[model samples]
Every structure is written in C-alpha cells, then in structure tokens.
Target: MTAPSEAARYSIQMLISDWLLIDGTMDNHVWSAVEQPGGDGAADPDIARRPEVARLGLSVRRAGWDQIAGWPHDLEGFTTWPAPGQTARMSLSGAQWSLVVLALRYWADVDERMSDVDGAARSRGIATSVEQRLVSLGWSPATP
Candidate 1:
C-alpha cells in the first residue's frame, strides 16, 4: 500500500487515561495502546487504528478511523485540546511510526496523569461526575 503523504502520515491518538474518571473526576492516570501483543508486537497491523481514539472515559469518545482523517493536521505536531499544555510522549508501533514526536506528545501526558491518580478508590461523587463527563465526551467503555 502507498504511504499516506507526510500530510496523511501525520496523526494523533487522544488517550483518555488521565481523563479516565474512575469515581467522578479525571482518573489522573497514564496509558498506552499496545497491540494486543501477538497482534502488532513490533509490526503494524493489517489495518491501522486511529491515533486519537479514546476509551474508558466519561467524556471522550471512541473515534473511528474515518474521523481521525478529519482532525487538524496543520498543527506543528501533536497537541492536546483545551490547550496551553505540556508535551506527551508517543510510543509508535509499526505503522504508527509514520507520525512524528509532536503528534505523540499528548499520549505521554495522559499516561503521566494516570500515574498521579494511581491509588485506592475515592468517593462516588467524583466517580459519578466522571461517568457523566465520559458520556458527554462520547466515550462508552467497551463493556458499558
């Protein structure tokens, strides 16, 4: 298959780990999209997944590949929305390597936040709010 142009190759995956919202607030955690092990390991999959897709969030939505195409590509590189932020790290796998560092920054940021929230459970109030935010954001955990 032909490689997407430098333009087509550029993309971002919005990880919701930091924004996961376990009780009712941002989960304040970090995450990464590892290929289901055997699936990608170090190789790209037969079909590439969206970089901006979010899962297990109260407000973020699971973006389809088609939607990823429409995201802002003109930016200097990967950036978080509601911006004025820090850089996240990107762990590019086979096909994902097409995108550069700037595009991968947000993922790193999300992962960092998750690390902050790592601990015992909190009150349900925050949890409920997170759920509402997840729905508002368009994210529905795969099981729910």
Candidate 2:
C-alpha cells in the first residue's frame, strides 16, 4: 500500500490527539460504541464493532503491520504508551488516521442506531435480546 501524504498524516494526528484523544482514557460512550458489532454494519458484523479489533483482525488476516503497533498506538504509530520517560514518538500516518476515523464513525452510527432501536423497542414493550437488537440495527449473525 502507498504511504499517506504529509497533510493527511498531520490531519489525522490532530484528530487523534485533539479530537478523539486516544492517548487518554476514551470516553465511555465512545468506547461502548466502538466496541459494539454494528459500527461498520459490514458483512463481518463481529469485526465491524470496534476499531482496534478491526485493526487487529485486518493485520492478522492480511499478515501486514503485525508487529508494528498495538491498540491505541501513539500519534507517531509507535506501540509505546504515553507515560513519562518514554521517548519514542512519531506522527500517525494517513492510513492509520483513516482506520481511526472509520472506527469512530462506525461507533457513532451504531450508537445512534442503538438509541433509536431501544426507543422503538421500549415503545413496543419489547424486551429485545442482544442479538435481536443487533439485527434490528442491520447486523447479521456470524455464519456457521
């Protein structure tokens, strides 16, 4: 794959550092949304849930970027944590930012969809099961 452009890298870095703030504890709602299976509404409902999960899944499936970085990689794509005494620092590339954006967007969409589904279910007096709720939001179950 081609490397991302410098402008794209900077834009993505700002998004992570300033907006998403991945270096810190992610917001509970954001985390919840990201960790759910409806984020991307993709065929692999399981993988579409969270960005980190998707990234790991992709890495393994594609056999690329396997050892490059871990979950919540720093701005510079390093796998190191952001505590004191760690000198490793690098900016996130455009591709990395794209993944992050995809996760965030997916989470946002799922969160909204869940809210709507819950509201509708409540109105209908239906105690929706998790699987049912996911299906209501357009997620298909894992195939045998």
Candidate 3:
C-alpha cells in the first residue's frame, strides 16, 4: 500500500500536539477558565475537550464514544451496523478522522481523571480501541 499523503502526516502531528496526546499534565499550561473574587472567568476549553465531547460535559457523564467505534474514515463514507439499515453518519473527512485516531492513540498518560471518575486507563482503552478499529479498516497511522 502507498504511504499517507503529506497533508495526512501533518494532520496526525498536529492532532497529537495541539489537541489530544498533549505533553505534560492536563493541568499544566491550561488557560485560566475560572475566576476569583466572585467573578467569572474561563479558558479556551474548546481546545481541550475531545471532538466527540461537548461543553455540557454530557459526553463524560455518558462515556459518550458509544457510537465512535467503526466510524467512517472518509467524510463521504458511513459506518454500517450489523443490523440492516443502521448506519453511523460521519462528518469528518478522511484526514480529519486520521488526526482524531492518532491523537487518541497517543494521548498523554497523565495522572488525571474525568469528573465522572474515569481515569487514564479508561481513556486509553477508548483511544486504543478506536485506533484499532480504524487500522482494521486498512487505515494506518502516520507514525508508530
């Protein structure tokens, strides 16, 4: 099989560094999203949450990646369920999907837990599972 395109490689790197698989503690370098003295302040949380998670924190509460497995690798593609006529709609392009997969696969092994008490191990499991599913469909990571 041919190697991934240049754009895809860059997407993988950017996903790991900028979004998922970030270096250092989850608390480190995070913007100040809270305020003191009865004032309200916030940071760019948009940069932190997984694409599958929304700000209401519903994703965490529900462990929301339930539908992520076998998601399509191409924007034009859809994931088919074993039962007839069931499919998961994917909004991300092939490159976007790649970036997400790599980011989750290489997420930083930090000592933190979600508000719902899910720890790094659980997070890693989700990541690894998704990445594996993608690989099973012939998608390859840009790096090991």
- Residue range 1-144, candidate 1, lDDT tens digits: 533222122123333232222212212211233234465535434224423321222122222212333333455543543244322222222222212121223333444568733332222333344345444544443212
Q: Pick the winner on TM-score between candidates 1 and 3.
A: 3
**Each prediction's Cα lDDT score?**
0.30, 0.35, 0.36
TM-scores for all predictions: 0.20, 0.30, 0.32
Find the 10 residues in a row with the least total lDDT in model 2.
Answer: 9-18
> Per-residue lDDT of 1-144 in model 3, one digit per residue for the tens?
433233322211112222222222222322221222234223334444433322122312121134334433564543332234333322233444444444444343433433433555545664566566566655565432
Q: Over the stretch 56-128, how does candidate 2's per-residue lDDT look in tens digits?
A: 3343223222322343535564444333332222334434433433444444445457786543333222212
Greater-lDDT candidate between 1 and 2: 2
Off by over 4 Å in 1: 1-71, 75-129, 132-144
Candidate 3 vs. true structure, TM-score? 0.32
- Which 10 consecutive positions of candidate 3 have the poorest summed lDDT? 9-18
Pairwise lDDT winner, candidates 1 and 3: 3
Highest TM-score: which candidate? 3
